[model samples]
Target: MINFSLFVATVLIWGTTWIAIAWQIGPIGIVLSVFYRFALAFVVFIIGLAALGRLSLPSQWRFVVLQALCLFSFNFLCFYKATSLMPSGLVSVIFSLATIFNAINARLIFGERVQSRTVLAGIIGALGLVLLFWHDVTVSLDLDVVQGIGWAALGTMFFSLGNMMSRKNTAHGVTPVIANAWGMGIGALVLLGVASLSGADFILPNTQSYILALLYLSVIGSVVGFSTYLIMVARLGSDKAAYATVLFPIVALALSTIYEGYEWYGTSFAGLGLTILGNLVMFSRIKPA
Candidate 1:
């Protein structure tokens, strides 16, 4: 039940994070916003861990660092860049491919079994994504947008690697909270260094709304979302927990309908049906060995 709740929380929070990202567009640059989001979240996490006496470094420092880089730094950078160049909905559709990437990579790297049902579900979900965002995809594709899709794909790949790494660390008995806090800290430092190198301005938004958005993103989106997700992965296993990705875009699309005033087209509804069906097939608890 706790695992189920974690999965639901992860999907709901991350689904709405796209809206939050949209709010971050004006005033702050993307890189700077990414840096601030993670850095602030890291600080808050560290303080919380200290208060709870739960903070500890991983035994395999190098692997932890690599996980941080892949999960936090590179993945986010690519995702942000992808959104910058393309529509959020389109970017999200591409991001849905993470399940496919994860399945393949897990099979190759971790000797995880690749079930036929999982593969079929992944394909159905991909098709659903396409249908859901068909309108957005039908729009003229600029060079930048094309490049953005590529980056988004790369980000998904990095994310899959991070998932595998997290599973590995969990097998070694490291608590997800401890691993996440340290990984986020390292990722924050790396992003900060990049910001410094790029001479990115780090001005705080004076508006109450902007400040509130930043706080929500840092605390709720980054820290809470990430920690809960890692915990879910630890409890549910990577494949099961990763179903959140399938559910997230659906939430995002729902939010879009309300906030962005997006109309629900027929294709969109069909896509939603297919996506849910695919997830059901993939996570049906049937072993595919």
Candidate 2:
């Protein structure tokens, strides 16, 4: 029952974040926006953990650093840029492939066995994404669209890698809240450094949309989203928890349709159906070998 609740919250919160991210896209640099989001989230996490007496640092700084790099910093850098170059929904769809990436990464890093069903699902989902983006890839000469797809793919892969680090921390008895508290703090610092080196503006945007979106992204999206999702990962395993990606994009696409005026055709709908079906296959119960 708890797992179910976490799953639902993860889907809803992250699903809406893509559009909120779109609101963040105007004058501010992507790195700075990401820094603001994580920086705010880091402060919230620190206060909450300190108040709860759970703010102790983890033993393995290396794992924490790995998690920071994969989850908090680089992935958002890629995702924010991706959203700028492509529709938020499309970025969500590409990011949904993290399930497969997680499975593969788990097999490699943790020696977790990958089921045949997972392989099959990957094939189906890959085909679906290809079909969904076929028109854009074939017809558009815009470099940004192509780069957006590449960024989304890289972000998803990094996200999967971060899940492995989370699993590692959990195995070493590090709680998700602690790992996230440190990870977000470290990640925020890293972003700040990058922004400084790159000469990006450190000033906040003067608009309400940017402020609200940053709040939403930090509090709900980063703090709540990462904490709940990583806890879910610890309990349910990364492969299972990542199924949220498959469903959340549906929510993102709906919002995109309404706000971004995303036009869809029969092919796109069919591709969505295939991707959902692929998720079903991937999650189907399998007997022990």
Candidate 3:
């Protein structure tokens, strides 16, 4: 039941965050917006943990630094940059490959065996993603689209690295909440330094929509979503937990259709069906042990 809840929460929160990111595109600097989101999240976690008397730092800072860099900071920097350069759905489709990346990384990093079912499910999900983004992929090669794919792929790989770090932290007996609190703090500081060095504007957005988006990204997306997802990673293993990415693009595309007027065709429905079926296959417990 806890795993189920985490899966649902992570999917719903992350899926909608794509739209919030879209809202965040104008005026404010991308790095600044990323900094603000994590800074706010860090503040919230610190206050919450202190209030609960659970504010101790990790015993080892190495994994925490890794977690901060990959998960809280760089991955999001890539993702927000990817979002600016590509359609949210296309970026999401590329991000969904984290499932495959996680499988490979888990095998290499932790000596975990990659199951055949997981590989098969990844193939199906990749096919579904291809169909879902068939229009974009088949279009005449634009430089921006190509660059967007590159950024998204990089971001997904960084995200997968963060997942491995999270799993390692958990194995070393760190709770997700405390780990995230420290990670967010370190990440926010890193972004602040980057923004300062780059001379990026630190000005907040003037619009209500952007402010609300930042708050939502900080509180719900970073705090709730990351904690739940890391919990799932600890519980289900990174290979299975990372399948949540497969579903994120589906929901993100659905939201895009409504907000961005993305036209859905027959192939879109077929892709959605295949993606869900792929998720089931990934999660199916009836396979041979």
Highest TM-score: which candidate?
2
For residue 57, give model 1's deviation from the true position in Å: 1.9
Q: Any residue pairs clashing in model 1, and if so which?
A: none
Per-prediction tally of clashes = 0, 0, 0
Q: What TM-score, over all chains together, does every model reach?
A: 0.89, 0.96, 0.92
Greater-lDDT candidate between 2 and 3: 2
Give the C-alpha miss distance for residue 283 in model 2, angstroms.
Answer: 0.7
Q: lDDT for every model?
A: 0.78, 0.90, 0.84
Clashing pairs in 2: none
Model 2 / residue 201 / CA error / Å: 2.2
Q: What is the lDDT of residue 68 in candidate 3?
A: 91
Question: lDDT tens digits, residues 1-289, model 1?
Answer: 8888898899888887776766666777777878788888889999999999887877776667777888878898888787667556555656666667778888998887888987788889778866765655575445776677688889889988888888878877777787788888898899889888999888877877667777898899889998898898888777777788777877776666676665677887897778677766777877775
The root-mean-square deviation over C-alpha atoms between each candidate and the true structure, in angstroms, is: 2.3, 1.4, 2.0
Kindly list the per-residue Cα lDDT of model 3 for residues 62-108, writing each as its tens digit: 88889999998999888888888766776776777787788788889
Highest-lDDT candidate: 2
Report the lDDT tens digits of candidate 2 across residue range 72-118. Answer: 99999999999999889989988888888998999999888988888
Candidate 3 backbone clash number: 0
Indicate the residue-level lDDT of 163 in model 2: 96
